[model samples]
Target chain A: MPQITYIEASGQSTTVNVPEGWSLMQGATANGVEGILGECGGSCACATCHCYVDEPWLAKLSAPTEGELEMLENTASERKANSRLACQIKATAALDGMVVHLPESQE
Target chain B: MPMFRFDPYSPLVDADPFPAYKTLRDEHPCFWSEEAGMWILSRYHDIVAAGNDWQTYSSARGNLMTELPGRAGATLGTTDPPRHDRLRGLIQQAFMKRNIESMGDNIRDIARQAAAELKGRKQIEFISDFSSKFTVRVLFAVLGLPMGDEQTVRDKAVLMVQSDPKTRAKGPEHIAAYNWMQDYAAKVIAERRANPTGDMISQFSLAEIDGDKLDEREVLLTTTTLIMAGIESLGGFMSMFALNMVDFTDARRQCVANPALLADAMEESLRYNTSAQRFRRSLQRDVELHGQTMKAGDFVCLAYGAGNRDERQFADPDKYDITRKPRGHLGFGGGVHACLGMAIARLAVRVAFDEFHQVMPEYLRVQEKLDWMPSSTFRSPLKLELSIK
Candidate 1:
């Protein structure tokens, strides 16, 4: 299990262990963390689960797909270079202790 | 010349479009339909690309052929980002997945009563008796409408999306239906505003975006859109789910034996036979694809049904196997304008399946004659006769 840290916009942090193959959105949502909507049920069809990846782990993650990128542009929050839909990021052992920042609002 | 002559208006194609979709994906990935007056993209890659490329392929024109271009801010589905973002942001909280999940019990209860009423019947009309009734009940619950008026509201909702030849020619009838819906919504909005009932409609009345609440016209249009979008396709989907159950005995058996597999089976049915066959998108600029140049203002049909069955995306595309775990299917569509009522749709299907299986797990298709509702986009039987065995 890889421990994932979800930091809210107000700087509240909570850590949870997510099994491999489960998405970070699933991890945060299942653990009852606020700010990640996952409205499309992790289909990447809705960009409600937008989050900003910390600089240290940004390079390790694959580039956002064209669909995800287009959807990211529709996020309620401003899009940064490290912004990604948490549903598109699968948890892996190498990503243990990774930090993700949630936007203030997903709508 | 296009490899396949595809006429979406033809009854034959509406009855079973998978064959035509296969032809389009295999021979002409970017085939142009003269009858529809739009370019049809069938392959999964092309369909996904066109849906995501909001700049080149625009929905601001309208997603339906009956609609004219440039009515961008009128509806959530018709507009692009910035505007779409602001409008959706105001009401998105009401339709969130968690909130929909909380309504599962009520949905299941509606399904249970509808299914129970069919007891001791030799032949049951699935659409009117079960699917439509169940769907309208859920719609009423979600919309905070009076349950006693379900039948009349259901009829109006149907006519709002009616695209049959006779109905299409009768323009006033269509306008009358639209007015009835808007008028009904206006009454509901007024009542909710006068007295905060805490229903979804009331929530819509109170929801404020950037210190401004949705205006009267926006409220009515948004409410009417939700009702129209929720009823027809969902009713059709439930009918199709029942059809799939009888068509595939082994798959159905596996689902009934293990309740967990029911969700996967429902998803498989959606992929195998999607209710929404096609949606239109206009070109924002001149673009070339498959040796053809499509200029701005040109309309194209994104064939989601064909894209779901693309061989490049799914192995053994024609097979309906529940174990396949069909993910990333374009059943609910893709990109920004993806179906807003998807959570409601999924909840309706799940609860209906659960309640139906609990009461009558075994059923037989009694009617050999089947006729699909004639529409350019949607596909479902007008009536389905089933016998509980």
Candidate 2:
């Protein structure tokens, strides 16, 4: 299991062990993380799982697909260089101790 | 105890199918319905798994149990992935939550206007007066369709979902409505192509992905399917939400007192009684579940309504608790083919309820016996007489 830290917009931080093959969105949602709604159940269709990857961990994660990019454009929060949909980032041992910042709103 | 039997088309089941759904989930999780000639999966986990595995339970053949002619491989709901993905990606831009949220004020205005129309009336038919009219108007406004023919379009949309129990297939009127909608959609697509606008139809006409655009037939089918679905399914869900409020007065009161609770209440209403009851998926490969093996080419019905009520998934699944935030509920279906208009549906319904509650905070169902739409795929009240005063 890879431990991921989710820092909310309110500055509250929660860490959870995300099982292998589970997306960051699934881990956050399943563990009751407040900011990530994961409204579409890990599907890239809904942009409700918007999150900002911490600077260091941004380089390790896979690049966003065209679909993810399209959905990112609709995120309620501001999109940044490190912004990503948590559903698109799969949890793996290589990405242990990754930190993702939750957006202010996921609407 | 009598042997459990389930029929999606039975008027009795149509009236109240929860008990039958419970029975299916418990004794026969993967029961085959002889009447409808389809295998039914009732458990929540089973439905979610089936919906996710599009390769096994395919939607390419046809998604509707009472599928209309020439609709199997035509539109978003009927196509498989790669193609389905492309179609969805192209069409999704217009339905994103951000875009829909901008329409909140307009939706609220429409809802307030509709509520105001019944200001002097003590008794009102909810479906006709409020739900259907509200949804149709919202959809037409969003799509840039003309309003004068709303009643005709609504009638055709309603008829499009109905199946003849005796014949076990689409009725004559259903076919007629399908043809009418097809022609209407073609004309609309042509007009939109000729004169592009900011509406959804125009967006579909102009939407492109890497130089690949929706062909005329694809646009036509998508338009036709959306009009019917946008009208009936969305309207039916609104009616169901109203029915839930009427039945669950306590929950309704809580929502009325605190507008914030309305969003959760809407979700609870969906989980408790979704308008979309059953949709079919063709088995692309042999799959075994609970001692029954569904062979390839066989049609399997994914009972979303039944799955939502599965006790294994939710505690006291039958109870309509406003606080229960059922995030992954099958209210919008699941997987890649989840309801595209979910954002719009949520926005419209929430705004509509908020506006309606402002005017009429409370209402009562005038009749105990309710008449539901005769459709296998969708479930909703055809008429709900309510006393506003």
- Each candidate structure's TM-score, on Cα atoms with residue i matched to residue i, is 0.80, 0.90
lDDT of 2 by residue, B77-168 (tens): 89998788888888887887767777888888889999898787888898888888898899888988777989989989989999887787
Model 2: how far residue B30 lies from native, Å: 1.4
Q: Chain B, TM-score, each prediction? A: 0.93, 0.98
Candidate 2, A5-37: lDDT as tens digits:
999999999999977666788677656689998
lDDT of 1 by residue, B1-389 (tens): 73468887778877888888988888888888887788999987687667656778887877865552222446777777656666776676667566677888888888889888876776788889888999888888876777787788778776766565533322565557777888887888887788887577788768876775666666777777777777888988888888998889898888788878888888888788888778888998998999888879999999888988999878898998988766657776765666777878887898788777787778888878788876677778888888878
**Model 2: which docking level applies?**
acceptable
Weakest 10 consecutive residues, lDDT, candidate 1 chain B?
B64-73
lDDT value, candidate 1, whole model: 0.79
